[model samples]
Target chain A: MNPAPSSSATDAAPVLQAAGLRKSFLSGEGSIEVLRGVDLSVMAGESVSVRGESGCGKSTLLNLLSGLDTPDAGTLTWAGHPPRGDRRAAFLGMVFQSFYLIPELNALDNVLMAARMLKPPGAAERARAADLLARVGLAPRATHLSTQLSGGERQRVAVARALMNSPQLLLADEPTGNLDERTGDAVIELLLELCRETRTALVLVTHNAVHAGKTSRHLSLHNGVFQ
Target chain B: MPWYLYLALKQLFPAGRKFPFFTAISVLGVALGVMVLVVSTSVMGGFGREIRRWTVDTTGDVQVRADGGINRPADFLAQLTKVPGVVAATPFAEGVVMLEHNLKPSYPAVRGIDVERVEAVTPLSKYIYFGKLDDLDDDSVILSSQLAAAIGARVGDKVEVYSPLLIEALKSDEAYLGRELRVCGIFEIGHQALDSSLVFVTLRTMQDLYGRRGSADGFDVKITPGLDPDEAAARINAALPPALHGHARSWMEINHDLIFILQLEQNMIFFLLTFIIIVAAFSVTSSLLISVVRKTREIGLLGALGGQPRQVAACFCFQGLVIGMAGTVTGLALGATVLTFRDNIVAAFTRLTQSEAAIERFYQFKQLPAHYSASYITAIIVCTITVCTLAGLLPAWRAARLKPVEALRSE
Candidate 1:
């Protein structure tokens, strides 16, 4: 697989660029504008955090970045080209606050499942999944189902799964929201280390100022624009 | 395995978890439907086969009759027996006659069959429960047990037999003779119609009685084993002389109305029983709907992991297919077991209730009959699986149309 464009190449072209993004929702009788206009950019191997109040569209921004949802009006590009449909998942991996590990599969299978979306995993990919699980400190729990794992361990597995396909960027929406303070810090630390080791750009969305402060660049969303 | 199929299997039979209750009920529903369909089909097939066997045994495989009486029955019988599939042929004369016995008169059909050739073409000799069939002679006759009982006659009792033609002749002031025939034998074929309304006499006696010295009514032809009676009849008809204007009919054609009624009843039962399977498919639909609702977040997760909408739909469809296949196999096994032990089961019931009268009154045979047809079973399985697959489509489509963001938001 092609390595995510190197930091030198990323210096010439950012990994992701978005401008004039807008989104809204229909309330009882009126439309609620979540984001009026937003502009953001993240370079390769860079870690950025977006901190906002609840309902301020932090998750919405992450969703748009992951291509899980579409902005009402905007131009969002990955490596200078629009990410289309499932190709977005191939280019970018997502980790959710709830640690959305499929309950039916074991930890190892869950990680492998993400790889399977791009292509059928081979022996080498299996080894990489094993390595990633070990990196997340859940190697011994590889065969344990999600139901059997602790909340922190499930989150770690989710983080491991997000990097399985060697995506160029990882979009984490409140990755530590469901964990206690200490467990959440550990999960954030592990997530940061993995992203740094792989040189994958990170877009972490959170409500915690301390977690937001750990990233290289910190931005706050207010009135639908980043500050 | 493909990822979608793997996911489908995992969702259906999740490891380390008890199987879901609603899914189990759906599977049971499908199994019950398939069981009833299979059992009913087998019973109906058995009934049809038995009826056909009885009809063929009583009427011979084919019957050939001329427009009028066959003048040279011996030559016609020779020609009939020469047909490729024709195994045996017998000449017989039939007419309505009145018999006076014990000062009582009754009308019954009198059939005159050649004693030597009758045994070759029919099971009439085997059905003679009392007396000897060979004892029938010029002045003697064999009466069905029911007819004999009706007339209060027995073997060695003399009875006067009068033909309608003979009666007409006498009424017109023409010479006619009534024969004093002795009842020589009594036969019971266990067929109510034949036993109650038919009597047997020698061919020469019937010829003399009817005033046709060398003519007979028809010839009964039995085909070789495994040959279709209709095809055999057609061949015989084609070979008959144009001047004779003879037509050969299969036993089924002779009892067309009865056979048609039986077939119609079987088809209606089959159609009605299929509804059971259809109803069971509704359970499948409901169960899948529940699963879809429960797994909404997981569906969104799959979508985020790059699963196509069509693939997501296929996962649920595969789940339904597995359930259907499992039910079909179990039902087929259950049906086979039931059919194999049907007689034993009935006997046990009979013993428990101490009732044999119901069986004797309702059925013509001592044992219940079941016929297993591979083609019919295949059709049932195919139809059941198709319905089950279709049942999955609604939920599958719903799942496919789900937006990943909305689904994930539910969690």
Candidate 2:
């Protein structure tokens, strides 16, 4: 379902590295281990796609990589350092299947929120947010509330928000799951194009095999391990 | 601004929205509680103030009295006026008399006042409603408004006064005739107790009727403005000789029981009305809890976007603070407006209910009174803001405890 990265890409150090990562959940009297010592590495400017069926620990892996959840036993690093709460905002960004745009804020404000989390947004941050919105082709609808937007438009806004802080790595968990096939294809294309143009790394979790094929590297997960 | 506070404000007063139902309702609840506290406390304070004013107006700032009638009042008066804070002093005599006009008889307390010095001490002329204080002489008397009505007497009417000495003279087997005096004026003091049962006569007339010459029961002392009555009374007590056995008491010390009851009532009202603000705080807590539950997914997204748990908690906490501040401001404005138009509002309501006369009969006030003290207003602000800020804690804790992974999974 995928191809290996080019020789030039592997020459650089990986932006995200995870090894021996494990996680579990309580199931009745006993516990069930969801992730068992998983290991992965991705280089700079690489778009890596992970495809899996439901409940295959794909989201759990994404959570651990983003530092939203702790791995029971593993070492995970972003740019060769352990994830810290204060450093998380400047190191990475995330996009969700639900798009998760705050309903109270407009499209432009939702994008600027990422930068605001890092620091108070100033003129440069505002310009970047506008440029990102224009890149996603939602510039004209920047002032519209998330509720007033359609599914495809909301995902585009989410993509713009994910890149607002110019983070090195973006973790997207089934971002296009809520949109139709044609819209999903367009979002995936725009996402890859933006990542490549900015030289930012991406880890996309998705169910569509065709969308997975478009990335620089693709992997399938089954029985809690990548194959 | 911090992102958390900025987002908090945006959540409460969202951009491009016409109506914010949650914020409006929450603010209104807190505002109403604050308004009631302000209005009720001010009205209670007003009643207390009015009582003090009339008490001092009727009795002067201080009254000096002896065990027996003071002998040679002229000497005591000279000493009384020489006190450091004493501005002036006037000698007075008091006794009960049987007053009869056109065969309608009433027993009323009568005060004998020195016309020239009484004005300097008690402002008695200000309360005169009919005729003039200058018209009162040894052959004339003044009646309280209600006492005049009871005897069906008016200015220029002749009334017979039977002093207590009449009974004493009769017991001694001596003939005594009641004095006939012309009514010269009627006064209304606006105090139910004082206005209903009192008459005034010249000091010389009272001395002759009581068979005491050149002597008076007590002297009313007026002190310098802004001087403490109790302090001035202490000064006056030190000025008189021990042989006179004279004791000076401030108006507050004389009306101690009434003042105590008024203070107790105001404190009880303040204690009871504070519960209203507590109830409003509970409403705020409930609303914020609901908001936290509803926004679980968005909160998870924030965590995914690198927001710390503490910052997320701050978002909800700031919302409560904003609501508290807005409600306090609005409530103060509303309370001030209502207090300004209190007389008109009372008039309209009394007219609508046809209870104008009933209010005067029961409350003894023709117009509603309101007073706002700095201390009481400060207490209200501090308590309301503190409770509202504390109300946000539970919801903030609940939000902070949520794990981003679990919250995202929640349906």
Off by over 4 Å in 1: A1-12, B18-20, B93-215, B224-228, B242-245, B344-365
lDDT score at residue B134, model 2, on the 0-100 scale: 98
Identify the leading candidate in terms of TM-score.
2
Model 1 over residues A127-183: C-alpha lDDT tens digits? 999999999999999999999999999999999999998888899999999999999
lDDT at B323, model 2:
80
Which consecutive 10 residues in model 2 chain B have the weakest lDDT in total?
Answer: B50-59
C-alpha lDDT values of all predictions:
0.86, 0.88
Please give the TM-score that candidate 1 achieves against the real structure: 0.84
* lDDT score at residue B55, model 2, on the 0-100 scale: 72
Off by over 4 Å in 2: A1-6, B173-175, B347-358
Local error of candidate 1 at residue A204 (angstroms) = 1.1
Question: Could you give the CAPRI-style class of model 2?
Answer: medium
lDDT of 1 by residue, B150-229 (tens): 88999999999999787679789998767899888898765566677788999999998888898999998899999988
Candidate 2 residue-wise lDDT, A1-227, digit = tens: 43245577878888888888899989999988988887788788999999888998999999999998899999999989998877878888888899989999999999999998989999999999999999999999999999999999999999999998888998889988999999999999999999999888999999998998898888887777777
